[model samples]
Target: MPKIRQVEIKSCRLETYSSKICVPLPAQNLPELLSVAQKLKELTPDLIEWRADYFSASDPKEIIAALEKLRAVIGDLPLIFTYRDYAEGGFVNLNLELRAAIIESVLKTGLIDLVDLEWQTKVQVREQLLQVARENKVSVILSYHDFQQTPANESIINILKAQQEAGADLAKIAVMPQQRYDVLRFMETVLYFNTHYAEIPVVAISMSPLGMISRMAGSLFGSAITFAVYGKESAPGQIPIEKLRPLLNLMSSP
Candidate 1:
């Protein structure tokens, strides 16, 4: 890759070839969320993704309260607040409006460092949420999830470009890989894009066990972060951080 773009979140940088790991907190309630945080205090990953789609609380007030406590418990660890809707592997049937509201509310809390907003959200709503995220000084990761088979390689780059054009601080895609070649194609696409363009950080994941190598080697090809399981997994193909880290370290070693 020529010169790559960088997006900094706390101490971590989302530039090309950086191996950062994120662990998801997939707890369904405040109590569960807190307990997980306590365990994660020592075994911290680079970023903590609160998969809020799993949250039992629907009210923005309750959600914000939970975040306030989470912030206190975790101290300065950066948080990436995310709520994926059912169309994209989310937990509940939460209408888009409520989802947007909860996200906006979370951004205003000053407790989170970034928010993951799906790329397929209604155009108007997506733009509005982006604006709020900016005004609150929180970075936005414009994300897309394809539970089905991965799309063609060209389509993958197109989706990333669209996300960048839409003002994403980071652009991410997670898709299922039906065959080994699917994972290879996804990695090649990322390498090609990073070679040609110098813009926002990007994340490209190929889901399921067959696609696991893409997660482990993604950074070498320009994908910034690898999602690993902590107490639970927010997505498929994730390995426990304990196991994931050693492999990552070995790969990065001289």
Candidate 2:
């Protein structure tokens, strides 16, 4: 087995062998954004993920300013900057180069703790952005999202291994499961990879209401971080942070 890695952000430590909660900020405007941040602060999530693709402003400067404001409100909490591509459940469709540029710009701001990069980005472009992220010391979460259906366990393991090979600090896979067995398969894949393959942290979830249990039970299977929603969910089947926090605590207790 590979050596397990641990990521420290603020007061929390995300061990490759452990689990934590991350809340997604899906607001589209300044007031709504700040409101979500303040409310999430009260809930005390382990990390804050700003789904930048959801914001109305497309300008890089405006996005940076908004992130700065978010940093002020969430003080010391880790922030994840994500500009998801529309092909993978995000709201907007931009030119691939434009999307890559936006991510590079966000990394330049130096305000975020991590950045989510899609695993499907072209190798040349992806490498360039990864280089920029490395220079800035920003951790990358190379992710794959399947909004329609879950793939076989072997395929999922390949995806995680690909992320590890690409030098991602964490690997995340989210799939929409059509049945209960798919959820189990997804968790099993997570367990297999974290136990037998790469040591990088993994965030695995099966989406939609049918896969809700995986979100709460992922920790048991070696998923390091799970996403929760405050108001609007960035992805399907995300539990509200308020409810998820207590449930996780209850489930984790002896």
Candidate 3:
């Protein structure tokens, strides 16, 4: 298998790789965000993702204020700031310049531990954002989502490779599954990529109920992170962090 990079972030004891459980905090506005943040503090997720696209605030300053509040509440837990794209199931289809401006503003605050940037973002825009993230020392996750159906094996592997080549700290790919076999296929593709060519850790998911097994057992297949929910799932197939912890522990043991 390709070796893990062994990078460490002191805030959350996060390594460059391994099966770390992450729960998405999907509150719509500042007040509700604080409520969910408090609830998440009592949970055991290794990482927390603030799904900013679900948030209703439009002004960049308000968004940054919300992030600052979230950081204060979460303490040292690693935080992922993600304003998912509308095409990839985000709440709104913000125009390119507006989206970049907001994300860049958040990065400048230096509160977020990681930022999820879509792979399909316009080339110049994506590169500029990547540079901003680097300047702030915020790790980048270049992500691709196929909400419709999982692509062929070659295509899946290709996307992962491209992400690593493009300079992602962690490469993530999430695809939908129509049949039971698609779940296995998705996991197998991740396994092949990690064992053969991966230089960076990967977050692989087979979205929806059919792919839930991948969330529980994906550590074995080389997925470095899994997304779960405390109460509401940010994605279609996410289960509760309470249940995911026990299951993940069981599967990871000797």
Candidate 4:
């Protein structure tokens, strides 16, 4: 089969989202996962994400089944498997073995195109996970989230650089901006990195109403992708993908 062509999002890292607004189907059961994917497909989202920690069964067999069902509906559009753990603002607290098992299983099949791994996982564990993903042609988005406060611009930039050095295809950082200055700092980091680092895509977002501008301004600063909710939200400051679609489209237009 011919490789499916991706959109050319030039101003930033990539161009053109499938234009299908993605909804978060944060469900655990296979049936529930598939149901949400189908709904998002009907709604015409360009992609779908399986918040894997929400899966009803963390067992390998059941997880693979759920993923396969999701891939069926997503077709060629990108699919992201986000197994967010509690330490990083997710609900899952599975042991490293289980976490690694799930990640390896998913990537081994190449069913999902992107995997969301936390930036602070053990180095050995992360190295192994990245190896499996790279071998399987999957991209890793090393993500960091701080609900309390935003880090300094230099720290944020360092975080992105760390992820890239750790073999990530992209670097994503989200924090709570306490004031307008915090927001400005985050934007500056994004803009500077976007202009200086053309090889890697950086996603810099703030997790509050004030941070909404970061999401809206992602393309301008060279963010490869931005997270938006479909039916349910997995994080703070996530605009509905429906609303985000037009916002990004308008931003992309000269």
- Please provide the root mean square deviation of candidate 3 (C-alpha atoms, Å): 1.3
- lDDT tens digits by residue: candidate 1, 1-254: 44657888888777767768989998999999999998887798898999888989999999999999998998888899998888899988899888998988888888999999999999999999999999999999999999999999889889988998999998998999988988988889888887886387888888999999977886578778899998677788998999999988887677
- As for candidate 3, its clashing pairs are none
Worst 10 residues of 4 by lDDT: 9-18
Q: Model 3 TM-score?
A: 0.96
Local accuracy of candidate 2 as per-residue lDDT tens digits, 1-254: 77878877668888754569999998889899999899888888899999888899888889889888999999999999999899988878888977887889989988998999999888898899899999998988999989889998899999999999889999999999999999888888888888899778898889999999888886688878988887788888999877887878876777
TM-score winner:
1
Model 4 per-residue lDDT at 248: 74
Candidate 3 Cα misplacement greater than 4 A, ranges: 11-17
What TM-score fits each model? 0.97, 0.96, 0.96, 0.88
Q: How close is candidate 2 to the true structure, as a TM-score?
A: 0.96
| Ranking of candidates on TM-score, top first | 1, 3, 2, 4
Residue-by-residue lDDT tens digits, candidate 3, 1-254: 66767435544543333578889988898999999998898885788999999899868999999998999998888889998889988988888889889999999998988999999999999999999999999999999999999999999999999999999998999999999999998898889888898888888999998899989886688777899888778899898888888998898887
- Cα deviation at 167, candidate 1, in Å, is 0.6
Quantify how close model 2 is to the true structure by its C-alpha RMSD in Å.
1.2
Q: Which stretches in model 1 have alpha-carbon errors above 4 Å? A: none
Clash pairs, model 1 backbone: none
Candidate-wise lDDT, in order:
0.88, 0.87, 0.87, 0.73
**What digit string (tens of lDDT, one per residue) describes model 4 on residues 39-83?**
777666555667888776888878888778778876776777888
